[model samples]
Target chain A: MNPTTLKLCLMAVLSLVGIGLYGLMICRNLIKMVIVLQILVKAAALGLILAGQMSSQINLGQSLGITVIVADTIVAVVGMALAVQVQRRLGTLDVDALSSLRG
Target chain B: MLEAILFALPILTALLAGIQAIRTRSLIRSALWLAGVSASIAVLFYMLGAHQVAVIELSVGAGLVTVLFVFAIGIAGAEIQPQRPIVPKTLAWVLILVAILLLAGFALPFATTVQHSTEPETTSVFWQQRGLDVIVQVVLIFCGVLGLLGVLAEEKAPLDQPMVDEIAAERERDLRNLEYQSSQSMVSSQQGQTR
Candidate 1:
């Protein structure tokens, strides 16, 4: 990545991280929470790629990025499934309603 | 100038997608915006010379993740309900402004100094150094899929009794109508025979 692109990537990472934090703090819905988390993970992946580029280890960064992508997909799938189950059993999608841990 | 713009396209795309994903009311629309973000990031990956990673990002991030999200939304039966933002509008905008200022302050100094790497082929690195991680990731994906199915497999009663009851009543009415029609047809045949 060029200097401009690197800066852009860093900018993206910062923006996404901020958005993810804000969303996670405020969103009441579980699915939305999962989406926000994905955003955060994406930022981390971008950061890893940027780090790799800076250090002249592009392959290492690419490998790490791949790992991040795989892990994120798994997280998203599991999280969405959990959200579906929560909506099924709890009758609400709101996080407040899911406060019960008895089950 | 064109080179800079070309490189900036994916970043700009990602920014727009993030904004849309955050602001969209419908969960499905949000998921779509997420797809947009993923696709843009894949483009960025490709531009960065990680071709294989870019393909995986496109396939997994843009394709599989979106499908899963859409499926989950379908299962949830969520409406196009507008979510109330956690922060007030003015507050959110103000926060965004602050974030932009901070990002600029942080990134400006490094912008001119970062050098592009002469990257080795990405595939060899994955197989050589990161092989174990790949295997583990594959295992994680398996576990995740199984876990999802396990969660979904557990049967639960319908959350809304009224909707279930309404469906039952509609079915019963249909059955009753069918019976009534059959009985009327039988009686009409007997009358015709007598005539």
Candidate 2:
């Protein structure tokens, strides 16, 4: 990739990270939180690939991206499972309602 | 022009999808929009010459994650009752804009300084060089599976005897109340018939 392309890609990654953080700050729903997390991780993975491309170690970048994908999948699965349990027990998915730790 | 178009298309799609994912009211729609974001990212990855990562992102990030989100929504609930955001919208936007600008300021100079390589190495580095990371990732995946099982497991009653006894007693009282109500209704019907 050219320097200009790299700059553009980096900008996109930053924009994505910003959007994800914004969503995390405002969204109260647990599942929505997970969705935002997924977005954030995707941008990170893109950044990893970009780093690899820049460093002339595209293979290393791709490998790291794959590792990130596997870990992210596990996170989503576990997050969803926990969200289901929270909804079942607390009767609401709002993170604010979870302020009281009482079962 | 074509190269510019290729980069612009995916980036625009990703930005728009991400914004919609956060803004949409329906949880399912939000998840779908997230999938859209993932797909666009995959496109960007492919354009960046990371074809393998792009495929995985399409399959896992766009496909599996979206399915998981939808399934979770199906179980938990689909509609999020509209509520005020935790942070006020104006303040949140200002903070986000400031953060993005700060990050870009820090990142842009470093990005410009890096010279692109003519010869790019591919998957050999992954298989030959990063064995430790692969093993650790495997271990992490196993732990995640175990954690999922633990979270989803049926809750056993508390070990405390008093608490168990109290729950049993409460259930019994509820059953008795239900029986009494049914009997009282039956008695009232009998009296009306007699009249």
Candidate 3:
């Protein structure tokens, strides 16, 4: 990747990270939070790819990036499932209501 | 020229999708936007020559994650009120613009060169150096299934007499409806025979 391309990729990562942080801070919905986490995961993956490209360790970077992607999918699936169950039992998807862990 | 455009395409797509994902109020639409981000990232990976990682991202990110989000939204059955997304949206854009200006002012002066591999094949490293990561990935997926099962496992609800009666009555009505339909079909068949 050229310098411009690299800079663009970095800029993309920063934008995604910023957007994801905004969602995480402002969104009250649990499912949306999980979706925002996915955005953050993509940013991390992109960052890893950029790292690989810069160091010419493409194989190592790709391997790590794939690991990140796998872990992210698992987390998203589990998180969403839990969110669904929370809505079912608590009767609300609001994070404030879920703040208490009283059984 | 083409290389620059190709490199920028996925980045542009991801930035747009990220903004949309953060700003959308509807859970389903937000999930779709996340999928768009994932697909664009996969495109970036492919363009960077990481074919294996790209395929994995395409399958798990774009495919499974989106489906899972939609299913969760379906089950949750909560209407996400359109909150004030403008604040976060504008803040995100402003921060991005600032970061771009800072990068241009500070980082562009060096013009550091990057060295990319000509062969993007990573299967060797995946099995050799990152075997443990793969194992961890499998464990994480298995744990996710277990976690889902744990969450969805419902306790037996105590059945009240009225609730039981209501259920039985509904079942009886359904049975009566089925019987009526079957009898009508049988009678129609006999009429056809007579004809």
Per-residue lDDT tens digits for candidate 2, residues B15-38, read: 999999999999999999999999
In candidate 3 chain B, what residue range of length 10 has the lowest lDDT sum?
Answer: B150-159
Q: What value of lDDT does candidate 2 attain over all alpha carbons?
A: 0.86
Q: Give me the displacement of residue A67 in model 2, in angstroms.
A: 1.3
Which TM-score value belongs to model 1?
A: 0.76
lDDT per residue for candidate 3 within B114-169, as digits (tens), equals 75446534777888777899899889989889867744556323575678999999
RMSD after Cα superposition, model 1:
11.2
Residue runs of model 3 more than 4 Å from their true location after superposition: B82-111, B116-121, B150-152, B155-195
- Per residue, candidate 1 scores C-alpha lDDT tens digits across B1-82 of 6666887888888878987887777889999999998999888878776677789989989998888898888888655456
Q: By descending DockQ, how would the candidates be arranged?
A: 2, 3, 1
A1-103 in candidate 2: lDDT tens per residue? 5678788899899989999989998999998999999999988999999888788767788999999999888888888887887887679999987886675
Shift of residue A16 alpha carbon in model 3, Å? 0.9
lDDT of 3 by residue, A1-103 (tens): 5777777777777777777877776787888888989898888898888778777887888889988988898888788777877786678777877877685
User: Could you say which candidate leads in DockQ?
Assistant: 2
TM per candidate comes to 0.76, 0.83, 0.76
